[model samples]
Target: MTTSSSDSTSAAASQPGRFRVGVQKFGSFLSGMIMPNIPALIAWGIVTAVVVNVSEFTEAGWEPTNALAGVIFPMIHYLLPILIAMQGGRLIYETRGAVVGAVAAVGVIVGSDHIIDQFNAALPAGEDQLGYVHMFIGAMLMGPLSAWLMKKLDAVWEGKIKPGFEMLVNMFSAGILGFLLLAVGFFVMAPPINWLMAALGTGVEWLIDNSLLPLTSVLIEPAKVFFLNNAINHGVLTPLGTQQADAQGSSILFLLEANPGPGLGLLLAFSVFGVGAAKATAPGAALIHFVGGIHEVYFPYVLMKPALLLAMVAGGMTGVTTNMLLGVGLQAPAAPGSIIAVYVQSLGGGVGNVVGVTFGWVLSAGVTFAVAAVILLSSRKRDMELGDQFSAAIAKTEAAKGKSSSALASLSAGVPSAAADRIRTIYFACDAGMGSSAMGASVLRNKLSAAGISDVYVTNKAISSLPGDADLVITQQTLTERARPKEPQAIHVSVNNFMNAPEYDEVVELVQQSGDDQAVAAGSEAPASSAEHASGTRTAVEPRVLTQDRIRIRAGSATQEEALREAQEILVSAGAVTGDYLQAMRDREATASTYMGSGLAIPHGTNEAKSSIKSSALSVVRYDGGVDWAGDQVRFVVGIAGVGDEHLQLLARIAELFSDESKVAQLEAAASEAELHALLSGVNDN
Candidate 1:
């Protein structure tokens, strides 16, 4: 069922091609900083648009009212830059880095202002003073730079401080570093950044003046397909566009990458002329792409046939040219590049502006649709002969994006049954392959083993290390997107909690069904059912892991962190692990929630912290009032410290005990610690 033809494209994405890895990583980093601050940018845009008309700003002797000047100017000059710096700093060193980054940003802001004031003072009496230079580029540079320096400084004396003087030394060192960085940012960083931004702005203006701006579509359309749309639009273009908009009240740069017309047209062409699953899904994908503002929906279509890239480029050029000729522009960056966002930003520029922008969008889509239709028609015979390439296209798209996309997943929902039958290798991925993914892999492995599904190879891996040949990939919902690109062929699954996700049972059922289907297809007697053997062996045995003293019923409610600490204290008190393991548990939870679903959460230290383990042990606590474990109601909390696979036997038994709703109810209703212990220990008997 796999498309062998896509192997080349998939390999290309897995390796490197025209795009440099360093450049992509840098673009991703820039978008990471800018994406979080988009709300602030949008708000600033709306306020500016509403306070004074953009058309009026173009007239001679025009000036903003005090309300507009007071709110609008300060937001671009100060608030936005500080927020961007804080986010950039946080990315580098967490909250402490964020504080230092903000401090450093302020220094650059004031320095740029000082430079502007000096230049304005030198201007002749009749000439207008130069506009204030926004320090966006300065913030982007100083934020991560200051935070990284702070981190390096902290590493110098880490764990070397004397007992109680640790706090004093840490506080003074960070303060001194922040102060010095502020001075450096003021003197050394601001001037060059301001000049660079000005130079870039001038370059963009030159392109527009020469009517060569449309040619940028050659780069932008291709980059968008490679998943650099956000990085290009939000990271580089938005900052430059915002500056232009502040001065001119509108900027064509905002429309450069944010125009949704080309994507809409490409999707429209697919809807009309595509084949198989792609044809069936194209209409829906087009809707999501054009109006929903998720441009990713169309990327897979382009990746399916890279020849379509030319069509996208042509469409993009047409949009840009139309906007340029009509003198139409957005008051702000049209985030998500949706038609709605474009129209909203086009307001306050008068009816002519709105009409012109709309016309440009329509023309772009029309041109792309025409070009893409011709391409699709030309290849219609070959495409039909090749069968559906939708799945392969999705794989390529995810590979290029460096992550799985939900939009792409929705397109392939009709064919899960086909993918399920071929499931042989499954991967459980997480940020670090040490804790959550490992535990999840263990749980799924146990399930598969019980089902006599020894043919399936299940293992845990860091998302970055996923092998491409996996048939199925399971990840935390938050990380599914990140895990997708690593193994584009895998049937990716997302779960809320790794421990007891309900999806586990469904996956087991799917495997069982697929096995049966394969046996029937081979025209042989189906293999003996393992379910009977598994169910019939429910006999009681002495509980080595669950002692009466270690079980607690009707424990008081606590926060998720407090519950984790309680679990850690119990394990520590039992002499199973060192006190340092508590921090490891906290660190593991920070990476991913330990919630196991089914009113159960198993809190454990990471694999790296296994050195702190003294012995294998388990502690169980039942919170009748219920503990909120990361938005899930948890009635049972289990703390585990395993030497190796010794703890997994009991852990598997616990998973089985929680798998049934009736048994879970019995455990929950247990009145005393002894009753709960007996009920838990009964899993071994079953």
Candidate 2:
């Protein structure tokens, strides 16, 4: 989920007497490693759910079909372990480590009583027993061990190995270390791990026999919100479910964490009764949660209102109870906790299973909504006016769009004065480092560049991979607790919208006014040109490309092209450009619509039309009645006039501004050039 970076500091992890931060960090890293393997895990589940019903083949007189199931099961059985081990090693030391981890896992795959007996004694008649190697267990153990061993060997040989023969030494070193770990896995680890596995299975069976399985949600629901769901689901529940499925043809364990009912119920309730952005964001999240199977979407909502955790717990227990009462289970795991995926996995379990799952979903949703509504209504704080929350939440919702919500109600609360300034390095973090967080980092990097702050290095990282040297940190509100424990010394800045100009402006001002108390960076020299004016203020200049005459508000036009033309005329009238640039703009539009989300569109000419430009300029045309641009209702059309690459930075700033709904709302409502110019003021290109 996307949230303002501003609300991060108040996360439970940031509070005292909660779970230790280190444990949370480990959970984040472990889950992150397992994230990429979910599809493969679900594929295995699908085959068991849809394709491996041997009885159906026998009834259809297609005995050969059963043979296909036999071939697939073995591969599926070993695939998860191999992949998990590979990912685990890759996380630690990259490709070489992954290779060593995979090689070492083979020993664990075959190390058990059956394999051991092959060398000791022959089996009696009718006793062709299978090996009891704990594949998942062994992989988890040997993967890291082997990777660590290989890393150590590399360190020892780093300078000793001949330069020309480095490849030979590195390859041989990894191979030898992996071989050693394989021996350890088979001879020293397998038997005890198998015993532990058996004990866990038996205890779980005991709980199921007594109808106490649903109580597990007391831990599961809370852990999930804390970003520990992957560890619990993949590392714990999945292995248990696989065992039950192997023995009894299905497992309720598979449905425990994957059930979508609880999250859906919470979202549905928030959509109806939630104050602020919660009401607007919840319904969409509900659909995504239940249908799209991205359960992560709802975690921030739960985190926002910790009381909602109870609602989730109650709903989870209800789903588990319903499944238990109906004697329903899935043949395989559901990849996403989505209803569609659950239904697909339920095929092997029959009509009863589908009905059970549906009933559980409905019951859980009903229960959760009731519980959540009661909590929201009863728990209003003295300082908080419910109506004010709604208003503030809406603006934040607009600013963040659909990414994340405020994790804390008091996002503007103060931090320690000693830690407020003098940050030399900035890190933008998120669940995955490749998406919005990366864009946020890029935005900040450009801002710092424009400010002539060459000493401050800006970078992006996954929440789990934050470096020790980071001086300032930024992340979504939901993940603040998860990230804070990693670097408590850094000046953490939480924000609702990475693209919000005000938020960037605030950070830039903080960085500009502060001294660098940390050691001087290697490139502490100032830039050749700075974004500061003679008045001694560092401001974003992207909006400077616009003159007062270029900002206009007009009635709706007949078509998208007419709107584009109207905006084009603003730049022409302002004497910002010359020649026929309209065709190139239209030509660019023909290739792809310029309608950026959040009720804004940016129309510009392609590189081929650069010759038509007389100067670099930006124009804003607001349509009060709104124009339809490629099916999207656009209220603001930003026309660009570029000479060479001068407009690219302006374009980036515009994209950032449009991403914040509240800002877009203000821009759309502006009546004069001053209001429009003020709104676009702090946004600029370097």
Candidate 3:
């Protein structure tokens, strides 16, 4: 988020008349908008109480209360963490799997705790075991995995499984997921979690004890308001919940389990400074701060003020450092937090742990705010200067969007539809009309614009509702498999990365092979209504060399520019010109050159503009020596294409040609035209 605000207001105006930033706010805000994780959070909460409180309630006289605590605590203990995890997933994934990831927090906690317990038991001299430190270490990893697992599971259950059977299918599907999840959590995550918790706990516990106690009133009180107030557990701490961590000042550590991490400084800066920095992300940031209590929004500010990073770094150290000095301890897991939990932990510190981290946060924030404010002001001035330039550019682009949306709805990779057949369309299908398909649509929108490709990309659920000649489903690999229609005139090909990863190669492949591969990618042996994989069924026709073919390409100087021009002209001469069809070459070149940077340049683009496989043209341009492309001198230009208008056999020839980099290299080095032609002839098109 950048530092630019539309409204200037009071800092103390809790009315959000200003703004706020920080991690707790961002995490919670994001996690909340995402799917609700109530079920998974509930399940994980059950696990935490059972495991953490099981030993505490084993007493004789206190058995009932302890047992009761055991039952309720784990479930509640899990809530904050689950919330934290779901928030983390939302920030990182932002696509469909956010709420669904709540289940993973359970596994992260369970697996990490078991491993940490083993280590705590092993520490020498019988020092009291550290608090639930394993949770923090595991929390980081949970977000990414939760995102992947949720996305993966979502794909399998909703995409591949038959409709009406979704619920039943998901039951078995979730089981498989659960088993795999448990296994990875146990074997893969456990060892690392144990080591990290041990490491982090060593420092974190020290902070909770001597350091946090002395500064409570200052740090904990304000932090409670600023951080995760929901986790403070204000009532539960009055009487110690049964846990060995209660013996000393350990309860302070227990409360940290539920409280939000430090975030006030970040919130203040983002709300004030980064006003218009990230418009889309800002609303989410605001929600996370106000309600969700995720404090990670501070991260982006940290990203901005890298020069003044020491302030935050110093603040965190002070938080951990002061806790160490205060000599407080806690038994409960460090949850994402609620206000009640923070209060109890502060109370548990007996005035010491509360005081230390308390002052530390203030001193930290005061120093951090000052630093962040200065940076924000500086950036604001810079932004203001750039505004006029940016505005004009935006307006120019905006005016150009004339009929772009309609054009998108009428996109075709081939030559703009013949004047007689003016309509060309593309459809995007996915399980949930809102999730992967939506993401794919966004990506394809960008791709189509860049490649000069226009096609109507529509979501699946919305597909049946509309009326049109639209078919040729563009969707995830699995959805096509699961939604197999009985009398399938609609043909589908596997799309990955929401169409972004399909990139030039995959997109061209999907376009050219659209109707033919409905089953093979599904791993279908061949359903009764099946068609062979598109690539395998095309008729092979001999490729005719149109120009007695002695092609020569060279990059003597200004490599990329020269290579691009030469290659484009060659392709155009070879019947491949269709309104800047060379755009892919431009796209890849701009993002990253295909020069491989090793005395070579491989310029390529989709030949979907053609009806025949006319993409089988190889113009080998060997510079006398080389040209500067990136850092290397490109000696060869390996032009590649996916053309369908040429002949069916040419597609196989092109694929075969690309497979042997060695042959391409040999051709690149060839001094004589005959040698390069011989090298191209070596690969037979079947």
Top candidate, metric lDDT: 1
Which candidate gets the maximum TM-score versus the true structure? 1
> Following a full C-alpha superposition, what root-mean-square deviation does model 1 have from the true structure?
6.4
How far in Å is the alpha carbon of 14 misplaced in model 1?
6.2
TM-score of each: 0.76, 0.60, 0.33
**Distance (Å) between predicted and true CA of 262, model 3?**
9.7
Per-residue CA lDDT of model 3 for 613-663, tens digit only, reads 245554556676666554345666655444332222332343334334675
lDDT of each: 0.76, 0.66, 0.43
C-alpha RMSD in Å of predicted model 3 compared with the true structure:
22.6
Q: lDDT rank, highest first?
A: 1, 2, 3
lDDT of 2 by residue, 117-173 (tens): 673466666765543433776677677678777766775544466659967877788
**Which of the two candidates, 1 or 2, achieves a greater TM-score against the reference?**
1
Residue 681 of model 1, lDDT score: 74
* Model 1 lDDT tens row, 53-166: 643655532455434656888898899999999989877766667789999999998988888999989998989888887887788888999888987787676547787996
